[model samples]
Target chain A: MEVKLASSYGFCFGVKRAIDIAQKYENSATMGPLIHNKNEIDRLQNDYKVGLYRDLNEVKPNDTVIIRTHGIPKQDLKDLRAKDAKVINATCPFVTTPQQIVKKMSQEGYSILIFGDSEHPEVKGVKSYGEDLEDVHVILEKSELDNLNFKHDKIATVAQTTRKKEIYLDIVNSLILKNKEVRVFNTICDATFENQDAARDLSKEVDVMIIIGGKNSSNTKQLHTISLENCSDSYLIENETELDSSWFDNKKLCGITAGASTPDWIIQQVVDKIKKY
Target chain B: MEVKLASSYGFCFGVKRAIDIAQKYENSATMGPLIHNKNEIDRLQNDYKVGLYRDLNEVKPNDTVIIRTHGIPKQDLKDLRAKDAKVINATCPFVTTPQQIVKKMSQEGYSILIFGDSEHPEVKGVKSYGEDLEDVHVILEKSELDNLNFKHDKIATVAQTTRKKEIYLDIVNSLILKNKEVRVFNTICDATFENQDAARDLSKEVDVMIIIGGKNSSNTKQLHTISLENCSDSYLIENETELDSSWFDNKKLCGITAGASTPDWIIQQVVDKIKKY
Candidate 1:
């Protein structure tokens, strides 16, 4: 089978920046997983001696702490500063923009609505910026809006950087239809759009699709989901080892795509393995 | 034929407030038509002896000028103040919100996208607030967006208060899909939503639909357009005098609705005349 790569795929500006920062600050510990990709984190840990602190309590005084791309909660950042840890913020600018917008708008008495997974680190961090926690709602579906009781008529909404634009638009349209004064901030990363668009285009022409990215990575999952819509024989794998030769038995062409958090090296391995199959 | 009125219709809060202000300030001249309804303007002119000034040049120094509900351009307001005219600002708060948002966002270096008719007074007023006029674009259709050359990546969009929510959503979705940092202000008025929803509901249940308001009124034209979507025999009339007996022929159930600027008295006349037919 012939292996083809998507026109736009793999490490986005934010993920690339975070990786660079992680590499530059060797021996420094990140507040959370620097990026969603476990393989990339492992590489950073082995090569640069970068350590991961899943909990804030793990960090010691005088330690250099690098903030992850998804960012930490406001209170956590304050606590880290109070602990006297030398902080190196590597939070994505796209993620930071929504945080600022939520802080400013919520402070000005506008109810905040975040269109993203509530359990996500990016969403949790953005939600913390709202002045009134009760007024800040994180919802994944448009139907969830019916359960929300907004304290203020004015609402400001922002989407997670790695989310699908169509889903974000659905939530925004629902908010606009119900609320009189809604402010929607489009915070979905540009790389996410390009990657998803490229995957969707390539998946249609190929007999089988292989999406390479961390299983937990939101943007990668989005790309896999989009590829599944076009090609039924689509598979999501972290590396070449996870690839099944049986899936590509009758496949004349194999299209490859990776999430924003995925590294080029991993994609190259996946492409090489598919060519061997 | 049975004449059934829509659940929500007639003069909205803005129009009612404008009318009340016009009545209170007798002998004053409105900078433009106070509302879109010609019959109501005639009532204000005849009953309160209020004058209408089509042009700013018609106003003499010290003339009391009541700003229209749609609002005049920023420069026009300044000129009126410079002429020492006593201006009783009657611009709707809903309309003012978009004007302020456009002025603030545009001044902060964001490109402005106005989803409305370029010739509309409300759009004209809101467009004037943009600090950089070159970056402000007034587009009626999503296709028009392709022709626009934006200097800034950050864009702020606002809809005309009287516009269709669905069309506005289409424009917003299109903007969000293309731009990374789009700020959407849902300036579509609450009354507009209620009126359109009510008209749509009532039109679906009736054999014929009659929309009452000024022919030139944006909201009134929108009501007629929506009514036509569900009811093929939809008719738009200014008052009972415009109604024809032929329209009621074989029509068993007639639905009635009026635009935001339409008066209840005119709606009552249309219903009473429809019953007679």
Candidate 2:
């Protein structure tokens, strides 16, 4: 069997930057998981003594706290700062753009429409940046636009950094038709687009596809979704331990793609284990 | 046989306003057919003594030159003003809006995308309103977007007054995905939307659909297209003379929908002819 990897797989620039920063500040506690990948978080804790704390209450006043790549809400950052904690901002610069836009556009009285999953931390954090939280709406699908009743004819929209560009534009177009004026910012990062495109391209040429990343990772899920659409025998696994040899029974070619948060070490381990077949 | 008319059919507000303005000025000549319906133009010439001239050269210095409902190119307007002719601005308010947006947005360095037929006068007039003619692109289909090489990241789009909303929105969505920023003005008139919707509603309950308006009428052709999709036995007719008795043979119900430019008198004549069958 032949094993092929996507040309643009493994950790993206933002995630790599976050890891590099966290590694330098050993024994520091991250506000949340530094990135979405579980194996990477485990490795960080075991090797570098980095700690993961979900809430601000868990951090000591003088302890160094590292912000996750997804960033924290404005209130949380204020709370951290008020406690006199040493803060290292590792928020992806792409995510920072939409936060600034939401704050500026909302201040200008344009109702903000954020195209993203509402429960995701990136979306939650971006929502906090708006001047008026009441005016900001997190929409996951196009159908949500119909449910919206807005008093403001002027609206502005921005998408999460990892969102599919097509879905973001679809909602923007619908909003543009209903409102008199709309300003849209395409905030999807180039790395996310490249990873998805690479996965899609690899899937088309392979008989069986294996996607390696955390199940909860949005970018990972998107890659798995794109792979499944192109190749029927596609599986998403977090680690090599979950890989089944049965998947390679009749497959001549196996394609692999990892999400943005997935580290190079985990991907190499998965490839070595697959070669054992 | 039962005859039914669309609730929102016949002369729309803009067309009616143009005709009302023209009737008030006797012996005046329209730059072109004031509206798409030829029958109405003939009626104006015979009863109202308003002639239709295709060129500005035909108008005397003191002659009242009535601009068509679709409006004229910017250069033509300037020439008419330069000649000191008495000009009646009958350009539809709905059509005038996109003209203003194209001019303003283009001046602000936005590449204009017009969802319209390339040969249509209204689209041509709107295109001429842009600050740079080279920056304006008339896209009739989505595939044309691939051929575009845009220098500016900012794109502003508007649709012709008679276009389908879905088609306009589809192109806008595509443009939004490709461009960094997009400003869209949905210029499809309310009357056109209402007429198409009413036609779709009527087609569902009828055995045969008869669409009435001028052959060259864009909105008329759109109505016929909508009718054909819902009811296979749909036909387009300009007047009572085109009605065939065989179309009504064994037909229990027939629905009639007139375009925005179709006058009430012509619709009545078609209904009368259908009733005789």
List the global CA lDDT of all models: 0.88, 0.87
The residue-level lDDT of candidate 1 at A257 comes to 92
lDDT value, candidate 2, whole model: 0.87
Model 1 off-target regions past 4 Å? A1-13, A32-46, A52-55, A161-163, A190-277, B1-10, B32-46, B92-94, B190-277
> Candidate 2, residues B1-277: lDDT per residue as tens digits?
6799988898888899999999998899999889877778999999899998877778789889899998999999999999999999999988899999999999999998888887988889999999988889998888888887766898988888455677777777777667777876657777768888899999999999999987887879989999999899999998899998899998999999998877999889999888877
Q: Compared with the true structure, what per-residue lDDT tens digits does model 1 show for residues A1-277?
A: 7988999999888889888998998899998788877778999999999999979899899999999998989999999999999999999998899999999999889999998889988889999999999999998877888899999877888888455567778888887767766677767767767888999999999999999888887778988899999999999998889988899887799999988777988888888888987
Chain A TM-score across all models, in listed order: 0.80, 0.81
lDDT of 1 by residue, B167-232 (tens): 888988887767756777777777878888999999999999999888888878999999999999
In terms of lDDT, the poorest run of 10 residues in model 1 chain A is A159-168
Best by lDDT: 1
Alpha carbon deviation, residue A87, candidate 2 (Å): 6.0
Write out the backbone clash pairs for model 1.
Answer: none
The structural similarity of chain B in model 2 to the true chain B, as TM-score, is 0.81
Best by DockQ: 1
